[model samples]
Target chain A: MKHYNIYVTSKPVIYDPAGRASENTLAKLGFSGIERLRIGKFIEMQCADDVSLESIKQMCDQLLANPVLEDFRIEIVD
Target chain B: MSDFRFGIVVFPGTNCEQDVAHAVRWLGHQAEYIWHQDTTVSQFDALVLPGGSSYGNYLRPGALAAASPIIAAISEYAAQGKPVLGISNGFQILTEAGLLPGALQQNASLTHICETLDFYVEKTVCQWLQLASGTMISLPVSHGFGSYYADAATLIQMESNGQIVLRDTQARIAAVCNEQGNVFGMMPHPERACEVLAANHPAGAGGTVFSTIVKHLEVVR
Candidate 1:
Protein backbone atom coordinates (compact mmCIF):
# COMPACT_ATOMS: atom_id res chain seq x y z
CA MET A 1 0.00 0.00 0.00
CA LYS A 2 1.05 3.55 -0.65
CA HIS A 3 -0.08 6.83 0.84
CA TYR A 4 -0.06 10.06 -1.13
CA ASN A 5 -0.39 13.60 0.14
CA ILE A 6 -1.87 16.21 -2.13
CA TYR A 7 -1.82 19.98 -1.79
CA VAL A 8 -4.05 22.09 -3.94
CA THR A 9 -3.87 25.85 -4.28
CA SER A 10 -5.11 28.61 -6.49
CA LYS A 11 -2.78 29.52 -9.32
CA PRO A 12 -0.51 32.45 -8.49
CA VAL A 13 -2.01 34.60 -11.18
CA ILE A 14 -5.47 34.07 -9.76
CA TYR A 15 -6.37 36.26 -6.81
CA ASP A 16 -6.65 34.57 -3.42
CA PRO A 17 -9.33 36.65 -1.69
CA ALA A 18 -9.66 34.39 1.34
CA GLY A 19 -5.94 34.31 1.92
CA ARG A 20 -5.70 38.08 1.56
CA ALA A 21 -8.49 38.56 4.09
CA SER A 22 -6.70 36.31 6.53
CA GLU A 23 -3.46 38.17 5.92
CA ASN A 24 -5.16 41.46 6.67
CA THR A 25 -6.58 40.05 9.88
CA LEU A 26 -3.21 38.74 10.94
CA ALA A 27 -1.52 42.05 10.21
CA LYS A 28 -4.16 43.82 12.25
CA LEU A 29 -3.44 41.43 15.11
CA GLY A 30 0.19 42.65 15.22
CA PHE A 31 1.77 39.80 13.29
CA SER A 32 4.80 41.44 11.69
CA GLY A 33 6.60 40.66 8.46
CA ILE A 34 4.05 38.26 7.01
CA GLU A 35 5.09 38.53 3.37
CA ARG A 36 2.51 36.30 1.77
CA LEU A 37 -0.22 33.79 2.48
CA ARG A 38 -2.06 31.51 0.10
CA ILE A 39 -4.93 29.37 1.34
CA GLY A 40 -5.18 25.85 -0.09
CA LYS A 41 -6.56 22.35 0.48
CA PHE A 42 -4.75 19.25 1.74
CA ILE A 43 -5.93 15.78 0.78
CA GLU A 44 -4.45 12.43 1.90
CA MET A 45 -5.22 9.21 0.12
CA GLN A 46 -4.11 5.60 0.57
CA CYS A 47 -4.20 3.20 -2.35
CA ALA A 48 -2.76 -0.05 -3.56
CA ASP A 49 0.94 -0.19 -4.49
CA ASP A 50 0.05 -0.78 -8.12
CA VAL A 51 -1.67 2.61 -8.40
CA SER A 52 0.71 4.60 -10.55
CA LEU A 53 1.51 8.27 -10.02
CA GLU A 54 0.14 8.83 -13.51
CA SER A 55 -3.24 7.60 -12.35
CA ILE A 56 -3.18 9.92 -9.34
CA LYS A 57 -2.31 12.82 -11.63
CA GLN A 58 -5.26 11.93 -13.79
CA MET A 59 -7.49 11.91 -10.71
CA CYS A 60 -6.27 15.37 -9.76
CA ASP A 61 -6.69 16.61 -13.29
CA GLN A 62 -10.19 15.21 -13.67
CA LEU A 63 -11.65 15.54 -10.18
CA LEU A 64 -9.40 16.61 -7.30
CA ALA A 65 -8.44 20.05 -8.66
CA ASN A 66 -9.50 22.42 -11.36
CA PRO A 67 -6.53 23.19 -13.58
CA VAL A 68 -8.06 26.38 -14.92
CA LEU A 69 -7.57 28.32 -11.67
CA GLU A 70 -5.73 25.99 -9.36
CA ASP A 71 -2.56 23.84 -9.22
CA PHE A 72 -1.85 20.71 -7.25
CA ARG A 73 1.24 18.86 -5.96
CA ILE A 74 1.50 15.22 -4.96
CA GLU A 75 3.98 13.57 -2.63
CA ILE A 76 4.37 9.94 -1.73
CA VAL A 77 4.49 9.24 1.99
CA ASP A 78 6.58 6.52 3.66
CA MET B 1 -45.77 25.00 -30.59
CA SER B 2 -45.38 22.69 -27.61
CA ASP B 3 -43.91 24.01 -24.41
CA PHE B 4 -40.28 23.19 -23.82
CA ARG B 5 -39.65 20.76 -20.99
CA PHE B 6 -36.97 21.99 -18.59
CA GLY B 7 -35.05 19.65 -16.35
CA ILE B 8 -33.70 21.09 -13.10
CA VAL B 9 -30.82 19.00 -11.78
CA VAL B 10 -30.87 18.45 -8.02
CA PHE B 11 -27.63 17.58 -6.30
CA PRO B 12 -27.35 16.32 -2.73
CA GLY B 13 -27.08 19.79 -1.21
CA THR B 14 -28.73 21.87 -3.89
CA ASN B 15 -31.47 24.23 -2.72
CA CYS B 16 -32.71 26.03 -5.82
CA GLU B 17 -34.20 23.28 -7.97
CA GLN B 18 -37.68 24.05 -6.73
CA ASP B 19 -37.23 27.74 -7.45
CA VAL B 20 -36.06 26.95 -10.99
CA ALA B 21 -38.96 24.56 -11.47
CA HIS B 22 -41.37 27.27 -10.32
CA ALA B 23 -39.85 29.77 -12.72
CA VAL B 24 -40.06 27.32 -15.63
CA ARG B 25 -43.67 26.48 -14.86
CA TRP B 26 -44.53 30.15 -14.46
CA LEU B 27 -42.96 30.79 -17.84
CA GLY B 28 -45.35 28.22 -19.40
CA HIS B 29 -42.84 25.41 -19.78
CA GLN B 30 -42.87 21.93 -18.30
CA ALA B 31 -40.56 21.51 -15.33
CA GLU B 32 -39.05 18.31 -13.92
CA TYR B 33 -36.49 17.54 -11.25
CA ILE B 34 -33.67 15.19 -12.20
CA TRP B 35 -31.70 13.57 -9.40
CA HIS B 36 -27.90 13.57 -9.56
CA GLN B 37 -27.70 9.79 -9.46
CA ASP B 38 -29.85 9.37 -12.52
CA THR B 39 -27.80 8.40 -15.57
CA THR B 40 -30.19 9.61 -18.23
CA VAL B 41 -30.96 13.28 -18.95
CA SER B 42 -31.77 13.20 -22.65
CA GLN B 43 -35.50 13.53 -22.07
CA PHE B 44 -35.52 17.25 -21.28
CA ASP B 45 -35.19 19.85 -23.99
CA ALA B 46 -33.32 22.15 -21.60
CA LEU B 47 -31.30 21.62 -18.42
CA VAL B 48 -30.75 23.85 -15.39
CA LEU B 49 -28.17 23.48 -12.68
CA PRO B 50 -29.63 25.66 -9.98
CA GLY B 51 -27.90 27.56 -7.19
CA GLY B 52 -26.81 26.14 -3.81
CA SER B 53 -23.88 24.44 -2.10
CA SER B 54 -23.88 21.05 -3.72
CA TYR B 55 -22.17 18.38 -1.61
CA GLY B 56 -22.11 20.98 1.16
CA ASN B 57 -19.37 22.81 -0.78
CA TYR B 58 -16.87 20.26 0.46
CA LEU B 59 -13.39 20.31 -1.15
CA ARG B 60 -14.71 22.99 -3.50
CA PRO B 61 -18.16 24.41 -4.01
CA GLY B 62 -19.06 22.17 -6.92
CA ALA B 63 -16.07 19.86 -7.24
CA LEU B 64 -17.74 16.69 -5.96
CA ALA B 65 -21.04 17.23 -7.69
CA ALA B 66 -19.27 18.02 -10.96
CA ALA B 67 -18.01 14.45 -10.92
CA SER B 68 -21.47 13.01 -10.32
CA PRO B 69 -22.72 10.56 -12.94
CA ILE B 70 -25.44 12.93 -14.05
CA ILE B 71 -22.87 15.41 -15.36
CA ALA B 72 -22.01 13.02 -18.19
CA ALA B 73 -25.63 13.10 -19.25
CA ILE B 74 -25.64 16.85 -18.93
CA SER B 75 -22.51 16.93 -21.08
CA GLU B 76 -24.25 14.82 -23.68
CA TYR B 77 -27.23 17.14 -23.59
CA ALA B 78 -24.91 20.11 -24.04
CA ALA B 79 -23.01 18.36 -26.84
CA GLN B 80 -26.30 17.98 -28.68
CA GLY B 81 -26.37 21.80 -28.91
CA LYS B 82 -29.19 22.12 -26.40
CA PRO B 83 -29.25 24.91 -23.85
CA VAL B 84 -27.72 24.21 -20.42
CA LEU B 85 -27.80 26.89 -17.75
CA GLY B 86 -25.93 26.87 -14.45
CA ILE B 87 -26.70 29.43 -11.78
CA SER B 88 -24.29 30.41 -8.96
CA ASN B 89 -22.95 27.22 -7.41
CA GLY B 90 -24.25 25.49 -10.46
CA PHE B 91 -21.93 27.78 -12.38
CA GLN B 92 -19.14 26.48 -10.23
CA ILE B 93 -20.06 22.95 -11.18
CA LEU B 94 -20.03 23.71 -14.87
CA THR B 95 -16.59 25.28 -14.56
CA GLU B 96 -15.35 22.36 -12.48
CA ALA B 97 -16.78 19.92 -14.96
CA GLY B 98 -14.92 21.64 -17.84
CA LEU B 99 -18.18 22.59 -19.50
CA LEU B 100 -17.29 26.25 -18.88
CA PRO B 101 -13.90 27.93 -19.09
CA GLY B 102 -13.39 30.04 -16.00
CA ALA B 103 -13.35 29.19 -12.30
CA LEU B 104 -15.52 30.97 -9.76
CA GLN B 105 -13.33 31.90 -6.82
CA GLN B 106 -14.13 33.65 -3.55
CA ASN B 107 -15.64 37.07 -4.05
CA ALA B 108 -13.00 39.79 -4.16
CA SER B 109 -14.29 41.20 -0.87
CA LEU B 110 -14.26 37.75 0.69
CA THR B 111 -17.83 38.29 1.86
CA HIS B 112 -21.06 36.47 1.21
CA ILE B 113 -23.12 38.71 -1.04
CA CYS B 114 -26.90 38.49 -1.25
CA GLU B 115 -28.47 41.35 -3.09
CA THR B 116 -30.23 42.43 -6.24
CA LEU B 117 -27.73 43.74 -8.77
CA ASP B 118 -27.78 44.89 -12.34
CA PHE B 119 -26.01 42.92 -15.04
CA TYR B 120 -25.17 44.43 -18.37
CA VAL B 121 -25.75 42.06 -21.21
CA GLU B 122 -22.59 41.84 -23.25
CA LYS B 123 -23.32 39.08 -25.74
CA THR B 124 -26.45 37.85 -27.49
CA VAL B 125 -25.19 34.75 -29.23
CA CYS B 126 -26.40 32.57 -26.38
CA GLN B 127 -30.10 31.76 -26.56
CA TRP B 128 -30.46 32.35 -22.81
CA LEU B 129 -29.74 36.05 -23.18
CA GLN B 130 -31.60 37.36 -26.21
CA LEU B 131 -31.80 40.96 -25.12
CA ALA B 132 -29.88 43.87 -26.58
CA SER B 133 -26.15 43.77 -25.92
CA GLY B 134 -26.10 46.79 -23.63
CA THR B 135 -29.34 46.20 -21.78
CA MET B 136 -29.09 46.17 -18.00
CA ILE B 137 -31.29 43.85 -16.02
CA SER B 138 -31.79 43.23 -12.32
CA LEU B 139 -31.06 39.84 -10.82
CA PRO B 140 -30.41 38.61 -7.29
CA VAL B 141 -26.96 37.22 -6.47
CA SER B 142 -26.35 35.06 -3.41
CA HIS B 143 -23.04 33.35 -2.97
CA GLY B 144 -19.68 33.44 -1.18
CA PHE B 145 -17.60 32.33 -4.13
CA GLY B 146 -18.76 34.42 -7.04
CA SER B 147 -15.66 36.01 -8.47
CA TYR B 148 -14.65 34.70 -11.89
CA TYR B 149 -11.04 33.95 -12.84
CA ALA B 150 -9.41 32.85 -16.07
CA ASP B 151 -5.93 33.03 -17.49
CA ALA B 152 -5.10 35.94 -19.76
CA ALA B 153 -5.17 33.85 -22.91
CA THR B 154 -8.53 32.34 -22.12
CA LEU B 155 -9.96 35.71 -21.15
CA ILE B 156 -8.68 37.20 -24.35
CA GLN B 157 -10.17 34.35 -26.35
CA MET B 158 -13.50 34.67 -24.57
CA GLU B 159 -13.51 38.37 -25.36
CA SER B 160 -12.61 37.86 -29.00
CA ASN B 161 -15.19 35.10 -29.38
CA GLY B 162 -17.96 37.07 -27.66
CA GLN B 163 -18.33 34.37 -25.04
CA ILE B 164 -18.73 36.87 -22.21
CA VAL B 165 -22.44 37.39 -21.83
CA LEU B 166 -22.94 39.53 -18.72
CA ARG B 167 -21.03 41.86 -16.47
CA ASP B 168 -21.84 44.20 -13.62
CA THR B 169 -21.58 47.99 -13.71
CA GLN B 170 -18.12 47.66 -12.23
CA ALA B 171 -17.12 45.61 -15.30
CA ARG B 172 -16.69 42.40 -13.36
CA ILE B 173 -18.01 39.51 -15.42
CA ALA B 174 -21.08 37.75 -14.04
CA ALA B 175 -21.88 35.26 -16.76
CA VAL B 176 -20.31 33.55 -19.75
CA CYS B 177 -21.21 31.05 -22.46
CA ASN B 178 -19.23 28.28 -24.08
CA GLU B 179 -17.83 28.42 -27.59
CA GLN B 180 -20.87 26.66 -29.05
CA GLY B 181 -23.16 29.05 -27.15
CA ASN B 182 -25.17 26.16 -25.71
CA VAL B 183 -23.66 25.93 -22.20
CA PHE B 184 -23.91 28.97 -19.91
CA GLY B 185 -22.67 29.73 -16.41
CA MET B 186 -23.58 32.73 -14.32
CA MET B 187 -23.19 33.69 -10.66
CA PRO B 188 -26.61 35.30 -10.30
CA HIS B 189 -29.93 33.88 -9.21
CA PRO B 190 -32.29 34.89 -11.98
CA GLU B 191 -34.89 32.49 -10.59
CA ARG B 192 -35.31 34.62 -7.45
CA ALA B 193 -36.07 37.67 -9.54
CA CYS B 194 -38.71 36.08 -11.74
CA GLU B 195 -41.67 37.21 -9.65
CA VAL B 196 -43.57 40.45 -10.21
CA LEU B 197 -43.18 42.05 -6.83
CA ALA B 198 -44.96 45.28 -5.91
CA ALA B 199 -41.96 46.56 -3.96
CA ASN B 200 -39.81 46.79 -7.06
CA HIS B 201 -41.48 47.83 -10.27
CA PRO B 202 -40.34 45.97 -13.41
CA ALA B 203 -39.01 43.48 -10.92
CA GLY B 204 -39.44 40.34 -12.96
CA ALA B 205 -36.77 40.97 -15.53
CA GLY B 206 -35.74 37.37 -15.20
CA GLY B 207 -38.94 36.26 -16.87
CA THR B 208 -37.56 37.60 -20.12
CA VAL B 209 -34.63 35.21 -19.83
CA PHE B 210 -36.83 32.15 -19.48
CA SER B 211 -39.22 33.34 -22.17
CA THR B 212 -36.34 34.01 -24.48
CA ILE B 213 -35.06 30.46 -24.04
CA VAL B 214 -38.48 29.00 -24.77
CA LYS B 215 -38.87 31.15 -27.85
CA HIS B 216 -35.40 30.22 -29.04
CA LEU B 217 -36.13 26.53 -28.58
CA GLU B 218 -39.33 26.88 -30.55
CA VAL B 219 -37.60 28.72 -33.34
CA VAL B 220 -34.88 26.10 -33.52
CA ARG B 221 -37.44 23.33 -33.67
Candidate 2:
Protein backbone atom coordinates (compact mmCIF):
# COMPACT_ATOMS: atom_id res chain seq x y z
CA MET A 1 0.00 0.00 0.00
CA LYS A 2 1.04 3.58 -0.63
CA HIS A 3 0.37 6.61 1.58
CA TYR A 4 -0.79 10.01 0.36
CA ASN A 5 -1.21 13.39 2.04
CA ILE A 6 -3.84 15.93 1.02
CA TYR A 7 -4.02 19.60 1.99
CA VAL A 8 -7.03 21.78 1.15
CA THR A 9 -7.61 25.49 1.54
CA SER A 10 -10.12 28.08 0.48
CA LYS A 11 -9.28 30.57 -2.21
CA PRO A 12 -8.00 33.92 -0.99
CA VAL A 13 -10.77 36.19 -2.32
CA ILE A 14 -13.79 34.00 -1.57
CA TYR A 15 -14.40 35.68 1.80
CA ASP A 16 -14.20 33.41 4.78
CA PRO A 17 -17.10 34.42 7.00
CA ALA A 18 -15.89 32.17 9.78
CA GLY A 19 -12.47 33.74 9.83
CA ARG A 20 -13.88 37.24 9.49
CA ALA A 21 -16.21 36.70 12.42
CA SER A 22 -13.35 35.44 14.52
CA GLU A 23 -11.31 38.48 13.58
CA ASN A 24 -14.16 40.76 14.50
CA THR A 25 -14.39 39.14 17.93
CA LEU A 26 -10.66 39.44 18.43
CA ALA A 27 -10.65 43.09 17.39
CA LYS A 28 -13.49 43.79 19.83
CA LEU A 29 -11.28 42.30 22.53
CA GLY A 30 -8.38 44.60 21.54
CA PHE A 31 -6.47 41.81 19.88
CA SER A 32 -5.90 43.73 16.66
CA GLY A 33 -2.42 42.38 16.03
CA ILE A 34 -3.69 39.39 14.04
CA GLU A 35 -3.19 40.51 10.46
CA ARG A 36 -4.41 37.56 8.45
CA LEU A 37 -6.66 34.64 9.24
CA ARG A 38 -7.27 31.56 7.14
CA ILE A 39 -8.85 28.16 7.62
CA GLY A 40 -8.10 24.89 5.80
CA LYS A 41 -8.00 21.09 6.07
CA PHE A 42 -5.47 18.31 5.70
CA ILE A 43 -6.28 14.71 4.77
CA GLU A 44 -4.14 11.60 4.42
CA MET A 45 -5.07 8.33 2.80
CA GLN A 46 -3.45 5.03 1.87
CA CYS A 47 -4.00 3.46 -1.53
CA ALA A 48 -3.29 0.08 -3.06
CA ASP A 49 -0.02 -0.27 -4.95
CA ASP A 50 -1.86 -0.56 -8.27
CA VAL A 51 -3.75 2.72 -7.82
CA SER A 52 -2.36 5.45 -10.01
CA LEU A 53 -1.87 9.09 -9.00
CA GLU A 54 -4.15 10.16 -11.84
CA SER A 55 -6.99 8.08 -10.43
CA ILE A 56 -6.40 9.51 -6.96
CA LYS A 57 -6.40 13.01 -8.39
CA GLN A 58 -9.66 12.26 -10.18
CA MET A 59 -11.15 11.04 -6.92
CA CYS A 60 -10.18 14.33 -5.33
CA ASP A 61 -11.56 16.16 -8.33
CA GLN A 62 -14.96 14.46 -8.46
CA LEU A 63 -16.26 13.63 -4.97
CA LEU A 64 -13.52 14.02 -2.36
CA ALA A 65 -14.03 17.77 -2.42
CA ASN A 66 -15.67 20.66 -4.18
CA PRO A 67 -13.10 22.48 -6.29
CA VAL A 68 -14.83 25.83 -5.91
CA LEU A 69 -14.41 26.32 -2.19
CA GLU A 70 -11.50 24.04 -1.37
CA ASP A 71 -8.07 23.23 -2.88
CA PHE A 72 -6.33 19.94 -2.23
CA ARG A 73 -2.88 18.42 -2.63
CA ILE A 74 -1.74 14.80 -2.66
CA GLU A 75 1.73 13.69 -1.53
CA ILE A 76 2.89 10.13 -2.03
CA VAL A 77 5.46 8.69 0.36
CA ASP A 78 7.51 5.56 -0.02
CA MET B 1 -52.28 10.49 -2.07
CA SER B 2 -52.26 7.26 -4.03
CA ASP B 3 -51.42 9.17 -7.17
CA PHE B 4 -48.48 10.92 -5.64
CA ARG B 5 -45.81 9.16 -7.62
CA PHE B 6 -42.35 10.67 -7.60
CA GLY B 7 -39.63 9.82 -10.10
CA ILE B 8 -35.95 10.01 -9.38
CA VAL B 9 -34.08 10.44 -12.66
CA VAL B 10 -31.02 8.27 -13.13
CA PHE B 11 -28.27 9.39 -15.47
CA PRO B 12 -24.87 7.87 -16.02
CA GLY B 13 -22.75 8.62 -12.94
CA THR B 14 -25.69 9.65 -10.77
CA ASN B 15 -25.03 8.36 -7.23
CA CYS B 16 -27.87 9.69 -5.11
CA GLU B 17 -30.93 7.96 -6.54
CA GLN B 18 -31.19 5.51 -3.66
CA ASP B 19 -30.81 8.21 -1.09
CA VAL B 20 -33.56 10.30 -2.68
CA ALA B 21 -35.76 7.27 -3.01
CA HIS B 22 -35.28 6.34 0.63
CA ALA B 23 -36.23 9.85 1.66
CA VAL B 24 -39.33 9.69 -0.50
CA ARG B 25 -40.34 6.34 0.98
CA TRP B 26 -39.69 7.56 4.50
CA LEU B 27 -42.43 10.08 3.95
CA GLY B 28 -44.86 7.35 2.86
CA HIS B 29 -44.77 8.47 -0.75
CA GLN B 30 -44.22 6.42 -3.85
CA ALA B 31 -40.89 6.80 -5.55
CA GLU B 32 -39.46 5.25 -8.70
CA TYR B 33 -36.11 5.30 -10.41
CA ILE B 34 -36.30 6.31 -14.04
CA TRP B 35 -33.64 5.65 -16.63
CA HIS B 36 -32.01 8.44 -18.58
CA GLN B 37 -33.39 6.90 -21.76
CA ASP B 38 -37.02 7.50 -20.88
CA THR B 39 -38.35 10.17 -23.19
CA THR B 40 -41.08 11.33 -20.88
CA VAL B 41 -41.64 11.68 -17.20
CA SER B 42 -44.55 9.43 -16.44
CA GLN B 43 -47.46 10.29 -14.21
CA PHE B 44 -45.81 11.82 -11.17
CA ASP B 45 -46.24 14.55 -8.62
CA ALA B 46 -42.58 15.59 -8.54
CA LEU B 47 -39.14 14.70 -9.90
CA VAL B 48 -35.76 14.70 -8.27
CA LEU B 49 -32.31 14.69 -9.83
CA PRO B 50 -29.72 13.63 -7.29
CA GLY B 51 -26.03 14.50 -7.21
CA GLY B 52 -23.25 12.73 -9.15
CA SER B 53 -20.99 13.03 -12.21
CA SER B 54 -23.63 12.35 -14.81
CA TYR B 55 -21.87 11.51 -18.08
CA GLY B 56 -18.65 11.53 -16.08
CA ASN B 57 -18.83 15.34 -15.89
CA TYR B 58 -18.16 15.33 -19.64
CA LEU B 59 -18.55 18.60 -21.53
CA ARG B 60 -20.01 20.14 -18.39
CA PRO B 61 -21.37 18.75 -15.10
CA GLY B 62 -24.84 18.37 -16.53
CA ALA B 63 -24.59 19.56 -20.11
CA LEU B 64 -24.61 16.01 -21.38
CA ALA B 65 -27.27 14.84 -18.96
CA ALA B 66 -29.45 17.66 -20.20
CA ALA B 67 -29.38 16.05 -23.62
CA SER B 68 -30.22 12.61 -22.25
CA PRO B 69 -33.38 10.91 -23.52
CA ILE B 70 -35.35 11.59 -20.32
CA ILE B 71 -34.66 15.31 -20.32
CA ALA B 72 -37.40 16.02 -22.84
CA ALA B 73 -39.81 14.42 -20.41
CA ILE B 74 -38.45 16.46 -17.52
CA SER B 75 -38.94 19.59 -19.60
CA GLU B 76 -42.53 18.62 -20.27
CA TYR B 77 -43.12 18.01 -16.60
CA ALA B 78 -41.62 21.33 -15.64
CA ALA B 79 -43.75 23.07 -18.27
CA GLN B 80 -46.83 21.58 -16.65
CA GLY B 81 -45.86 23.19 -13.32
CA LYS B 82 -44.94 19.95 -11.61
CA PRO B 83 -42.25 20.31 -8.98
CA VAL B 84 -38.67 19.36 -9.84
CA LEU B 85 -35.50 19.57 -7.80
CA GLY B 86 -31.85 19.14 -8.71
CA ILE B 87 -29.40 18.79 -5.84
CA SER B 88 -25.66 19.41 -6.30
CA ASN B 89 -24.72 17.97 -9.69
CA GLY B 90 -28.45 17.58 -10.10
CA PHE B 91 -28.62 21.35 -9.78
CA GLN B 92 -26.16 21.59 -12.66
CA ILE B 93 -28.33 19.35 -14.76
CA LEU B 94 -31.37 21.56 -14.18
CA THR B 95 -29.49 24.62 -15.35
CA GLU B 96 -28.30 22.75 -18.41
CA ALA B 97 -31.86 21.52 -18.99
CA GLY B 98 -33.18 25.07 -18.74
CA LEU B 99 -35.63 23.84 -16.13
CA LEU B 100 -33.99 26.37 -13.89
CA PRO B 101 -32.04 29.47 -14.77
CA GLY B 102 -28.47 30.39 -13.87
CA ALA B 103 -25.47 28.12 -14.17
CA LEU B 104 -23.40 26.70 -11.30
CA GLN B 105 -19.88 27.99 -11.83
CA GLN B 106 -16.73 26.48 -10.42
CA ASN B 107 -16.44 27.28 -6.74
CA ALA B 108 -14.79 30.63 -6.17
CA SER B 109 -11.64 28.84 -5.05
CA LEU B 110 -11.77 26.20 -7.78
CA THR B 111 -11.28 23.41 -5.25
CA HIS B 112 -13.25 20.37 -4.18
CA ILE B 113 -15.21 21.40 -1.03
CA CYS B 114 -16.89 19.07 1.41
CA GLU B 115 -18.44 20.50 4.53
CA THR B 116 -21.68 21.42 6.25
CA LEU B 117 -22.63 24.82 4.91
CA ASP B 118 -24.77 27.37 6.70
CA PHE B 119 -27.75 27.74 4.34
CA TYR B 120 -30.30 30.42 5.15
CA VAL B 121 -33.84 29.95 3.99
CA GLU B 122 -35.01 32.91 1.95
CA LYS B 123 -38.24 31.36 0.72
CA THR B 124 -40.59 28.60 1.85
CA VAL B 125 -42.47 27.96 -1.37
CA CYS B 126 -39.86 25.37 -2.33
CA GLN B 127 -40.53 21.91 -0.93
CA TRP B 128 -37.00 21.21 0.30
CA LEU B 129 -36.88 24.09 2.74
CA GLN B 130 -39.02 24.01 5.86
CA LEU B 131 -37.77 26.71 8.21
CA ALA B 132 -39.95 29.82 8.38
CA SER B 133 -37.60 32.22 10.05
CA GLY B 134 -34.31 33.61 8.80
CA THR B 135 -32.43 30.80 10.48
CA MET B 136 -29.27 29.26 9.16
CA ILE B 137 -29.57 25.55 8.52
CA SER B 138 -26.37 23.56 8.42
CA LEU B 139 -26.24 20.93 5.70
CA PRO B 140 -23.43 19.05 4.05
CA VAL B 141 -22.30 20.31 0.65
CA SER B 142 -19.97 18.30 -1.56
CA HIS B 143 -19.30 19.63 -5.00
CA GLY B 144 -16.64 21.14 -7.23
CA PHE B 145 -18.93 23.43 -9.24
CA GLY B 146 -21.62 24.77 -6.95
CA SER B 147 -21.13 28.49 -7.33
CA TYR B 148 -24.06 30.15 -9.08
CA TYR B 149 -23.50 32.57 -11.96
CA ALA B 150 -25.87 34.83 -13.86
CA ASP B 151 -25.96 38.36 -15.16
CA ALA B 152 -26.79 40.99 -12.56
CA ALA B 153 -30.09 41.80 -14.21
CA THR B 154 -31.22 38.20 -13.98
CA LEU B 155 -30.14 37.95 -10.37
CA ILE B 156 -32.05 41.09 -9.50
CA GLN B 157 -35.07 39.86 -11.39
CA MET B 158 -34.97 36.54 -9.62
CA GLU B 159 -34.72 38.18 -6.24
CA SER B 160 -37.50 40.63 -6.97
CA ASN B 161 -39.65 37.87 -8.38
CA GLY B 162 -39.13 35.61 -5.34
CA GLN B 163 -37.50 33.02 -7.56
CA ILE B 164 -34.36 32.93 -5.45
CA VAL B 165 -34.47 30.82 -2.29
CA LEU B 166 -31.96 30.15 0.46
CA ARG B 167 -29.48 33.02 0.30
CA ASP B 168 -26.71 33.35 2.82
CA THR B 169 -26.90 36.46 5.02
CA GLN B 170 -24.44 38.18 2.72
CA ALA B 171 -26.97 37.69 -0.12
CA ARG B 172 -25.00 34.93 -1.74
CA ILE B 173 -27.72 32.82 -3.33
CA ALA B 174 -27.60 29.13 -2.51
CA ALA B 175 -30.72 27.95 -4.30
CA VAL B 176 -33.15 29.08 -7.01
CA CYS B 177 -36.74 28.47 -8.12
CA ASN B 178 -38.25 28.51 -11.57
CA GLU B 179 -40.55 31.35 -12.57
CA GLN B 180 -43.69 29.31 -11.97
CA GLY B 181 -42.15 28.35 -8.60
CA ASN B 182 -42.70 24.63 -9.06
CA VAL B 183 -39.10 23.78 -9.73
CA PHE B 184 -36.18 24.32 -7.35
CA GLY B 185 -32.48 23.54 -7.55
CA MET B 186 -29.98 23.60 -4.71
CA MET B 187 -26.45 22.39 -3.98
CA PRO B 188 -27.08 20.79 -0.57
CA HIS B 189 -28.29 17.25 0.08
CA PRO B 190 -31.43 16.88 2.18
CA GLU B 191 -31.61 13.21 1.26
CA ARG B 192 -28.19 12.36 2.59
CA ALA B 193 -29.20 13.86 5.90
CA CYS B 194 -32.66 12.34 6.06
CA GLU B 195 -32.07 9.42 8.43
CA VAL B 196 -29.76 7.87 10.98
CA LEU B 197 -29.52 4.47 9.30
CA ALA B 198 -26.75 5.87 7.15
CA ALA B 199 -23.67 6.60 9.24
CA ASN B 200 -23.18 10.06 7.77
CA HIS B 201 -26.85 10.93 8.05
CA PRO B 202 -27.17 10.32 11.76
CA ALA B 203 -28.46 13.41 13.56
CA GLY B 204 -28.54 15.48 10.39
CA ALA B 205 -31.74 17.56 10.38
CA GLY B 206 -32.09 18.14 6.66
CA GLY B 207 -34.98 15.67 6.58
CA THR B 208 -37.32 18.63 6.43
CA VAL B 209 -36.82 18.48 2.68
CA PHE B 210 -38.63 15.18 2.38
CA SER B 211 -41.42 16.07 4.78
CA THR B 212 -42.01 19.36 3.04
CA ILE B 213 -42.07 17.71 -0.36
CA VAL B 214 -44.50 15.14 0.89
CA LYS B 215 -46.68 17.91 2.23
CA HIS B 216 -46.68 19.55 -1.16
CA LEU B 217 -47.57 16.27 -2.78
CA GLU B 218 -50.50 15.90 -0.43
CA VAL B 219 -51.74 19.28 -1.49
CA VAL B 220 -51.41 18.27 -5.12
CA ARG B 221 -53.24 15.06 -4.43
Against the true structure, whose TM-score is highest?
A: 1
| TM-score of chain A in every predicted structure | 0.96, 0.73
Q: Estimate the TM-score of every prediction.
A: 0.95, 0.70
lDDT (0-100) at residue B76 of candidate 2? Answer: 82
Model 2 lDDT tens row, B28-91: 7789998999877857778999999998996458877877878888888888878898999999
List each candidate's DockQ score: 0.82, 0.03
Candidate 1 on B61-158: residue-level lDDT in tens?
99999999999989988999999999999999999999999888888887899888888998657778855477889888899999888888999999
Give the per-residue lDDT of model 2 (tens digit) for A1-78: 989887766666455655767777889998868998876667788879999999989877654544544567788875
Quote the chain B TM-score of every prediction.
Answer: 0.96, 0.91
User: Model 1 chain B, poorest ten-residue lDDT window?
Assistant: B197-206
Error of 1 at B74 (Å): 1.2
Query: In model 1, which residue pairs have backbone atoms overlapping below 3 Å?
Result: none
